[model samples]
Target: MANARKKKRADIPARDRILEAATRLFTQRPFDEISAEDIAREAGVAHGLTFHYFGSKAKLYEEISQAAADRLDRIHLQATLAGSAPEKLRSFLVAHMEEVHRRRVDYVFHSRGGGTAAIQDIWERSRSHGIRLVLGFYGVTAPSLELAVATRAWLGYFDELVLAWVQGQITNKAAIVEMAFRLFPVAVANAELLGEKNLPSV
Candidate 1:
C-alpha cells in the first residue's frame, strides 16, 4: 500500500500537487500564515519549485482564486437554454448550490477573501456572470439601468443566502433556492415599476 501510494504521488504532476497543497493550506488558514516553503513541504516538493512554478505565494493564491471563479462561471454557463425562465433559474440555483456545497471551504474562502483586491475582483466577476445568466433567462440583453440595478440587488441577496448556508447558519438548501426563485418575479416587477420596459416573460 505504501509503495503504491508513493507511486501514485510520483505520477501526479508537481505543479498540480503544489496547487492542491496550497489550496488545502489556504482554505484552512489565513493566506498570510502560509509560506512557499510550507506549501512545498506539504506538497512534498522542493521549496524552490514553489517559486519556480508560481513566482510567489501571492501569485499561487491568485491562481487558486481565479480557478475557483472560473469553475463557477462554467457551471452557470451550463444552465440549459431550453427551459422556461423560472425553470432555468431553478436549474442554475441547483447547480450553484451543489458546486458551492462540494467546495464549501474554497467557496467560503474566496467569497470572503480577506479584503484582497484580486480575490475581490474574482468574486465580483463571478457575480456578474450570474447576473448575466439571470438576465438571459428573461431574454434581456440590453437591460435598462433600473433593471440592471434591480438584478444586481437580487444577486446580492442570493449571495448572502448561499454564504449563510455554507457557514451553517441555514440548514435548508431547498428553502433558500425556492426563496430566491419566488423573489425573482418581484425583482422584475420592481424594475418594471422603475421604468424598465418589455422584460420577456419569466
Candidate 2:
C-alpha cells in the first residue's frame, strides 16, 4: 500500500499538482473555508508539500488568483480595444463576465481572514488595468491624473453594478452596459476634472 502511494505521487510533478489542486479547490470554494491540507489531499501529496511549495495558504490562494488574472489578460487584452469606446467597453465587459463565469472563481468579494489583502490587491491591479483599457479604447493619447482618477471612480461603480448582476440582484446585462456607457458623462459632471474632449461620447 505504501509503495503504491509513493509510485502515484511520483507520477506527476509536485508543484504542478499543487497548483492544479489549488486552482480547482479555490475556484469551487471561498478562500478561507479551504485549508492547505485540503489542497494537499486533493492533489494527492503529503500535507507538508503544500507548505513546502507555496510557503503559506495565503500564498497558494494568491497563485490561483494570479493564474486566473493572467489568463483573463491574455484572452481579453485586444478584444477590448476593437471598436468605439462605448462599443469597446461593452464588448470588454461582456467578455469579462463570461470569463468570470467560466472560471468559477468570483471569490474576491467572498474572501475573508488572511486572504483579504491578496484578493484586494488583485482587485486594485485589475481595476487599474481596466481604467487604462478604457483610455486606450477612447484613444486617450496623453494621460492626465484627473481623467485617470475620474475613470478609476467609474470603474468602481461599474464593478459594483456588475456584482449586483452576478448575484441575481440585477438581471439586466443590457441595463448595466447602458449605464456603463453613460458613466463617462456622469464622471465628468461629478468630478469636473475630465474635459469633454477627454471623455467618451457614446
Candidate 3:
C-alpha cells in the first residue's frame, strides 16, 4: 500500500509532489530536522528536484509555512464575512482546531516557540490576525492602547488553552470556546479599569 502511494506520488508533477511531501514531513518534524534528501525520498523524486523548484530547503520551508498561514487567513476571512459575532467566533475556533489537528505536530512546535525567526514571524502574523478577529467580534474597531494590550493578553490565555487541547491535555473544545466567550468580557472590563470604558459584550 505504501509503495503504491509512493508510485502515485511519483506520478504527480515534480514540484507539487515535492511540496506535498515536504508539507507532510514538516507536519511530523521541525524544519531543521528535515533534509532536502528526506523530502526527495518521500516525494519519490530526484534530490535535485526540490532545489530546482525551491532553490533550498529553507526556501521550501518558507513556502510551506506561508501557504499554511495563507490557508488559515482565508478561513478567518470567510468566518468574518458570513456570521453573527458568536457564530463567527465559534466557526473560526472550530476551523482553527481542525487545522491544528490536521497539522498537530507542526502546530505544537510553533505554539511552544520552537521555530526560527522567520517561521516565528509567520506564526505571529497569524496570531495578530486572530487578535484582530476577536476584537472585531467584540465590536472594537479602534482599540485604545489599553484595550489592545488587554486583548493580546486574553489571546495568550486562549492560545494556551488551545495548545493544551491540541496536545491532548484538554478534551472538550466546546468548553474551551465557551470559556473564551465568557472570559473575553472580563478581560475587556479589566481594560476598562485601566481607563477604557463602555466595551461591548461578546
- Winner by lDDT: 1
Return whichever of 1 and 3 wins on TM-score: 1
Estimate, for each residue in 90-198, the C-alpha lDDT of model 3 and write its tens digit: 7777777777778888888777777667888997888787877778876877778888888888878877888899888999989988887678778888988878776
Ranking 1 against 2 by TM-score, winner: 1
Ranking by TM-score: 1, 3, 2
For model 1, residues 35-87, the per-residue Cα lDDT tens digits are 88899999999999999999888788889888877988888878655688878
Q: How many residue pairs clash in each candidate?
A: 0, 0, 0
Per-residue error (Å), model 3, residue 36 = 1.8
After superposition, which runs of candidate 2 have C-alpha atoms over 4 Å from their true positions?
Answer: 1-10, 103-105, 110-118, 188-202
Q: What TM-score do all the candidates reach, one by one?
A: 0.87, 0.81, 0.85
TM-score of the candidate numbered 2? 0.81
- Candidate-wise lDDT, in order: 0.83, 0.72, 0.83
lDDT minimum window of 10 residues, candidate 2: 105-114
Candidate order, lDDT descending: 1, 3, 2
Residues 54-149, model 2: lDDT tens digits: 899888777777777777775568677466667777788777767766654444433222355766788567767777777777666555777778
Q: For residue 92, what is the lDDT in candidate 3?
A: 74
